[model samples]
Target: MVAKMAACTGSKDGQDSILEPLCFPEQPASSTSAPSLQGPSVELLVCLFCPESVPLRQKDVLLKHLLLDHKLVIGDVRLIADLPKYMLYWRGRFLEQPVSDFCSVIKTNSTGPLEKQEDYFLLCDVLPEDRILRERLQQKRLEEVLEQQQLERDDSSFHRLCMFCSEEFTGNRSSLLNHMAREHSFSIGLPDNIVYCKQFLDTLQDKLDNLQCLYCEKTFRDKTTLKDHMRKKAHRRINASNREYDRFYVINYLELGKTWEEVQSEDDRELADDEDDDWSDWWAHPVSAVCLFCDHQSETMEQIYSHMKETHGFDLHQLRTELNLRFYQQVKLVNFIRRQIHQSRCYGCQETFECRDDVLRHLVAEGHVMTLPDASTWNQPQYYFPTYENDALLCTLSDSDEGENGETSHVEDVPVIAEDVSELRALKQSSVLNQLLKSRGCSS
Candidate 1:
């Protein structure tokens, strides 16, 4: 009965009755059309305030845009919180990154699971502003340090502190020496402290190298040059008898309870007094005529002489010295003028003039006096010798005719040649003056 029933059930569809499967095997999906869990197709950095979006390529460029273009300050909590919402595409998806993760990566300085581009961008957004501020502060600090160092160097160069007394001094060695002598009674060559004394002496020698000529007030590089200048200019011969006259001594006006401010005010008053003098006008309108004695500009030789005598306090000795110096200077200037005369040029200005008269006019108008002494005076015999009655030496002019007649005729207050050294010796025995003259091969 069961076989008949099965046959009948199959017979209804028996002509094409094949056993049909209840379930079919599942077909694999096409790889090309499959959806991926990795997120979106394009990566972009979108602006929060505008519709502008930049390709997520470089972190720095994006950060610069945010800071400069959008005027955003990085590291703000609100901005960082809102950053993911503005990011149109992140990790190939729109707003796929969590705000916490994004902020964490932005704050980090190291590379990790996050893409390097995103990591750097985050770092740039958070740290650059602070970094720049710190760098600027460091640069300012460095500059301040350098300025302080320079100030210290300048102070050391201009001023020195006494190692023993800790007193600061701003003048030369002679001033320091005088201070030591006066304040401490310290003699430089004491046998008790010979080594220390020698060291101090060496320092003084070094300082003396930078001294000025006491007579001419001209600065020299070293003592040798100063000595040479004294010899060549015959300053020693002129001031021979007055040994202490030209010596440089530092006077401590401050010791008398006078302040530096008071001294400065007194100096200013003196300068004001000088400005009220006639020479101030002379200086204001500089003339071509320079003084032979001191390079002082004057309209005439008489004016020059007056200036030297009154302003410089020149004695007969100083006047004779200046006269001698002037003679040589005049000779040089005359030669220069002669050479330039043919070219119709003013020797002082070195500019071409219309004629010799024009040059002369320019020279005279500009106070360029180049007057030579009378030819008669050039050949006259002159002498400078100290008199026992006065500290200053007397200049005498000897009559040439009287000299030829074997009789010495003395002209009062004029430079003359002395025939008798015995007469000078009879007047005074100045060992210092004798040694000075002897060094210059002169018999005093």
Candidate 2:
């Protein structure tokens, strides 16, 4: 469906047209051809090998080191039939995950323990192009062997002349010629040692040039040999070693001093009340010289020791031993004061109450009427309630009886009942007095 959409397009006339025909009916389903993909020139072909030199029994130790140290991913693996008992790391971690995605099973450069080197080298020797290169090299060597045999059998006079110098030579003419051409400047016929050796070395050096290093034209024979040299500590030391050491030491020293300066600056800020303008606050002492716990200061000596014992539960000897402090006599003292304050109670009943409501309840429950202290008769504490009536008073008495009988009142809470109870109680009280007058034959 995607292919069809990709292939279909619109022409200028606004009609749909086939931009490209999708591959379908003609193509075989069983085609094993690899899909074309754009990739890097040097593909990262990973390989991992765990040597027996390590103390650990598991190969995961070495695989973990590869990921942690070298930053490589192990893509896929095929078990070596001869050594199927060994453990393998499928990816970045220890895993038994299926690994069919990789081009091949690969082992990385893990070579040590003298016996492992040959096997490791053999594995490296088997690169994807290695077989073809080896065959070509073998054929070339065979041709050289045949040519050498023919030269040995030849009795021709041309054998007496050097191949390189063209000078007369009797025995082993080819060797003498190679010696002259490779080592000494003997002939200018084709190429001399000075010109060709310099050029050849230059070409070899160019082939081995790395991003950070240049191979020495005078030292190594070829690029591979130069690479071997590059792996050595001496060669690295010769190339940008100063820069590496300087970079590492500079980073370490800077990190060390950075923490020191940070701590010092934090202490300075804390002492100065975290304010840049308050420099004097760093040195200023508190107004009171008395210590909070012992109530002692720098002023008193003998009384300070006594205060330490009574207030802080610390004798001079105990304080000195446990707290690692100097003489308590060196300390000063301030007064430690303690006192109590009494609150007022109800005047008539002498009952402790925080507010007016409790005093009013006391008076009402006792069947006593309340009036101001200046009134002719002072029976109870008085409160101003303009809405109070006899009918409200009787209703309150009925609600109180219901409460004493363990019934839930229609009123929800204290605030609502408190607001309406005073008026209801007053109304109930007046109604009772009127009924008493009617029963006594008095006028309404």
Candidate 1 global lDDT: 0.39
Clashes of 1: 18
The best candidate by lDDT is 1
TM-scores, all models, native as reference: 0.15, 0.13
Which candidate ranks first by TM-score, i.e. highest? 1
Point out the worst 10-residue segment of candidate 1 by lDDT: 1-10
Point out where model 1 deviates above 4 Å: 1-158, 163-165, 189-407, 410-444
lDDT string, candidate 1, 1-444, tens digits:
000111111222112121211111122222222121122124666664456666654435666776667444345322231233334323232145443443334334355554443332332244453344434444543343334333322232334554335577763333344455556544442122121222334444444455655344567877678767866885432222332321111111222222233445575544666436655355452223332233244555456556755653434324334455333333433333333443455445455655555655666677544433343332222212111112110112112223457664455533455343564576556678887888999987
Q: Model 2, stretches more than 4 Å misplaced?
A: 1-103, 106-140, 152-444
**Model 2 lDDT tens row, 292-348:** 221134334435445545644434334223433221111210100000001112323
